[model samples]
Target: MFAKLKQRWQDTRTIMKLSLDAEQRALREGQQHPGAEHYTLAALDLPDGSARRVFARIGADPEAYRAALANRHTAALSAIGLAAANANVTPAGASSAADGLAPPAEPTLLFDAQPSGQTLMQSLPELQRRLPAPLCGAHVLLAAAAMAHSAAGRAFKAIDIDLQALGSAAEAELRAAIPS
Candidate 1:
C-alpha cells in the first residue's frame, strides 16, 4: 500500500513539473498572463518514508510523452482558440450580441495559484472569463493554477488515448459510414 502511494506521489510531481515548464514557455513567449496548461490541480500524495528528490527526477517515457504532450497542447490551444472564436460569434438570433454583451471581454489569462500558494502576478483578460463563476471574485487569481493542472491532465490523457488508437482506421471507417 505504501509503495502504491509513493508511485502516485511521484506521478503527480512529474505532471506538475511538466506543467510548470509549459507555463514558463508561455511567459517567455510574451503571454502576459499565460493561461493554465491544465484545467485541474492535482493534489500531491507523498508517502511516508518515500525518498525525497528534486522534482525533475521523474520521466514520462520521453519520446512517447513528448509527442503526446505536443498533441494535447495543440488540442488544448485549439480549444482555447475555439472558445475565443466563439466569443466573436453572434449569440445566434440575438442581434444584440453584435454591439452588446460586453464583446466577450478579452480573457485575462493567469494561473490561479502557484507552487508555493502565492497569488499570480496578474490575470489576463482572456483567461479571466472562462473561469468558474463562483471562483471568479475570491479565487480568480488562483483559477490559473487549477486550470493549468486540469489542462495538463486533460492533455496527457487525451494524447495517450489518441496514440493508443493510431492507425486503427476506426475513425476512417466511421467517417465513411456517415452521410455527407
Candidate 2:
C-alpha cells in the first residue's frame, strides 16, 4: 500500500512539472497566465507520446498547430492595432527550446493571474477520473477538447479540424491503450 501511495505521489509530481512547463511557455509568449492553449502547446512538445499519436490520428501536425496558434495570437494583436513583433515577451531560458520538451534551465516566475474561462484546470478532475494511473499528454489534449469554448477549441475550429471527431478518436485510443 505504501508503494502504491508513493507511485501516486510521483505521478502527481510529474503532472505538476508538466503543468509548470506549459505555464513557463505561456509566460515566455507574453501571456500573464497560462490557459488551455498553453497546455495544448506543452502537450505537443512531448517528444514522443500519446498526444502526438492523437494528433496523427486526427491528421494534424503538432508543429503546424503550434505555428498556427502563434499566428492566431499575432492576428488577434494585429486586429487590436498592436505590433506582435514589439510585444514585450521574454526569450525562453536556455533549457527551453522553441520546439522541444526540455525543461527550462532556470525556474520561471509566473504571475498570479487566473486562466481564461475555459481552461484545462476546470476539466482535469473529470479527465483524471476517466484515465488510468499516470496522466499524460494525451489526457491534457482530451481535457482541452472537452472544453469546447476554450482558446484551444477556437484554434482547432480556425484550422477546420472537427474537434468532436478528434475528441472521439482520442477517447477510443485512450480506452484501447488501457489494459483490462
Candidate 3:
C-alpha cells in the first residue's frame, strides 16, 4: 500500500544531482556560480532525456546546445572587444557573484549570470513550491523558457527557434514526467 504512496512523491536526488551538475557546468564555463544557462546546459545532459526531447521536438540540435551556449557568451563578450574565444573570463578586480556585487559602473555583461539569470535562480524556491516534488530536467527547461529575453533566448532566436513551441514543449515534457 505504501509503495503506491511512495511513488507519488519523487525524491530530491534529481534536483540535487542537477544542481551539482549545473555548478560543474558553470565551472567548466569559467564561472564562479551556476546560472540559468549552466542549469539549462546541465539539464540537456540529464540521463532521462526529457529536456533533450523537448528541445529536439522544437528542432534544436540538442548535442550542439553546449557549444551554442558557450558561443552566446563568447559573442556577447566579443561584442565589447574582449578576447572571449576561450571562456576563462575571470579577470582581476572582477567581483565574484557570490558577493552580490552591485552592477559595474561601466557597462558590463556578466555572461555567467546573464541579466535574466538571477531571476531564474530566484524563481526556484517558488517553483519548488508550485511544481511537482523532485523537479527534473523538464522543470529546468520550463525555467529557461521563462527567460525568453535572456542571452540563451537570443541564441535560440538566432538559430531560428520557435520560442512559443519551446514553451509548449517544456510544459508537455513536465506533465509527461509526473507520475500519473
What's the TM-score of every candidate structure?
Answer: 0.26, 0.78, 0.69
The number of the candidate with the highest TM-score is 2
Candidate 3: tens digits of C-alpha lDDT, residues 35-59? 6776777677778788888887777
lDDT of 1 at 36: 37
* Order of quality (lDDT): 2, 3, 1
**Candidate 1 residues 1-41, lDDT tens each?**
98657755754454345345334333332233333332111
Once fitted onto the true fold, the runs of candidate 1 whose alpha carbons sit more than 4 angstroms away are 1-23, 28-30, 34-60, 76-149, 159-180
Residue-by-residue lDDT tens digits, candidate 2, 1-180: 987688579657656666676677766666656777777777766653878888888888776666667777778878999876653543222122343443334434432324642357656657767866356677778877776677778877777778887787678667766646
Model 3 alpha-carbon drift over 4 Å, by segment: 1-11, 85-118, 122-134
Question: Which pairs clash in model 3?
Answer: none
Q: Can you give the lDDT of residue 50 in candidate 2?
A: 77
- For candidate 1, the TM-score is 0.26
TM-score of 3: 0.69
